[model samples]
Target: MSETNRQWLLAKRPDGRPTEDCFEMVEREVPDPGPREVLVRTRYMSVDPYMRGRMRDAESYAEPWDVGEAMRAGVVGEVVESNSPRWEAGDVVNGNLRWADYAVADEDQLVPVDPDRAPISTALGVLGMPGRTAYFGLLDVGRPKPGDTVVVSGAAGAVGSVVGQIAKHAGCRVVGIAGADEKVHWLTGELGFDEAINYRETESVRGALAEACPDGIDVYYDNVGGPITDAAFAHLAVRARVVVCGQISLYNAEERPTGPRKLGELITKRARVEGVLVRDYVERYEEANERLAHWVADGVVQYRETVTEGLENAPDAFLGLFDGVNIGKQVVQVSDPEN
Candidate 1:
């Protein structure tokens, strides 16, 4: 008898707004690690908005996954078998791995995770790429100043939640824009956002933004771009910094949707819109994790996670991003960590 590994593979390229049919589940005999590699049993897996971009046939920042091949994602796992001198059985590690029950990783591909420091799941959320994204996107790119009014779109998400809180810590008036009323309240209440607008309930997002940001938005952290972006641009103050973090709204559109021709406004407002990628600041991850962990401990920063039980539901969890289903970091619990 042989052990089997269950995996999810890309069934086909999506025409527009991928459905569950785009994914296929299969099982294969468990694989053994080669020299300098370790076999890991996955515990937690991450599903993010960026993964939507990967489902396309065209090239992008992330390499597209080939059809019939196992889909890859960020995962925290326990090393069950090791052929590398750097790792051993029972060691906890995390890296970009397959959406499967098990994965084989090279020594350099995975970094050690201290389970005692926090839940191992944090390796896939706040203490991971999402948190690093917020830290760099807000501090380095946005350059938010004290007394500045910072507005965060998708403010209830994994990255947006952190960005808004970090802005608050900077002594900025943090305004959040979310879809649901509870999400909006969560931002204004527990997250310490000065104000939050529920776009779904608002008659006009632009008008609501104008009212919330009476002084004009000094910093705009955009995650879900679309009409919200058009509205946010209209309320920018002089020399505003607009950080283009994620444009999740357009990720599923079959054809490009025409948007407001508002580039001309940048000339008058003297505003700067820049994109931030966490990979660009990979060398500074330790800096961010350390600072963020400190803030979480000091009650200055907070986080949340929406876990989808079982690896079989990973595709469903990923699709939920476009629908704004999850409140914070959306992850899948694949298995329990071995103590």
Candidate 2:
């Protein structure tokens, strides 16, 4: 075991899109676990769009990340040392842990991960928060009925990709809006979406949506807000359900910029718009996890991961989110786990 641990601290609050300067790497001795605690060596660290919001000093759904503190992220790790009855060395675990190679956490703060079931890294991706966000946000909030047209923005991203697939499984005509042509292909070709639009290549998002969704959109699972959301709003069917899972497009906006005023569209279409926070569905996570696992095992649903190697590159992986540099879940590979 290494004598020292390297951690990324929140150096400064980001004014707009975050840069590497906002994070400072610090080295500290790898502390031993005390009573009822375990020392975990991180294997994977997830860098998500939601973390961008947490970088702001203001409070949101989750608390803001304080400057000069180790940034927290969804981490999958292996227990290297244990002082807890429930955990032993070599046990795989997952939790919201600091961005360090090793973390000393109370046993209750860590959840056991079954390496035999799936890749343990999945505990930070498809089997973790992003997957649950997709499941509950689309099913509980969007409420897409069979034969309904379900459109997902940021459709190639982790949550959006899962949202589209789940909507398809529920017998909806799924349309995906992505940034790149390859992402569009992956959605319509492999993931079984009925159609996909490349928002970057298209002349107008609203025009493309009109062409693709000839019957109008019955459900809009929004991951990227801004023009795409406005376009989706313009095509809402009667009683359409809109699921606001993320707004990555607006995450970096320094000043809140206004766009298409469309509250009247909701009134006219009788549409229901609702925002979702994954923490609110924690009580029902096991139900979603079981079902998602079954679907994954049966090949009913698929997922992709864009991984950046090394803990040192974690900040770069985060900056990539705003740049649209990843196709699915963006995670940092910190170390290899012992089998």
Report the C-alpha displacement of residue 299, candidate 1, in angstroms: 1.7
Write out the backbone clash pairs for model 1: none
Model 2: per-residue Cα lDDT at residue 65:
86
Model 2 clash tally, residue pairs: 0
| Per-residue C-alpha lDDT of model 1 across residues 9-79, encoded as one tens digit per residue | 99998988999999999999888999899999999999998887788878899998888888999999989
Q: Candidates' TM-scores?
A: 0.98, 0.98
Clashing pairs in 2: none
For residues 130-171, could you state the per-residue lDDT of candidate 2 as single tens digits? 999999998899888999999999999999999999999999
lDDT at 60, model 1? 92
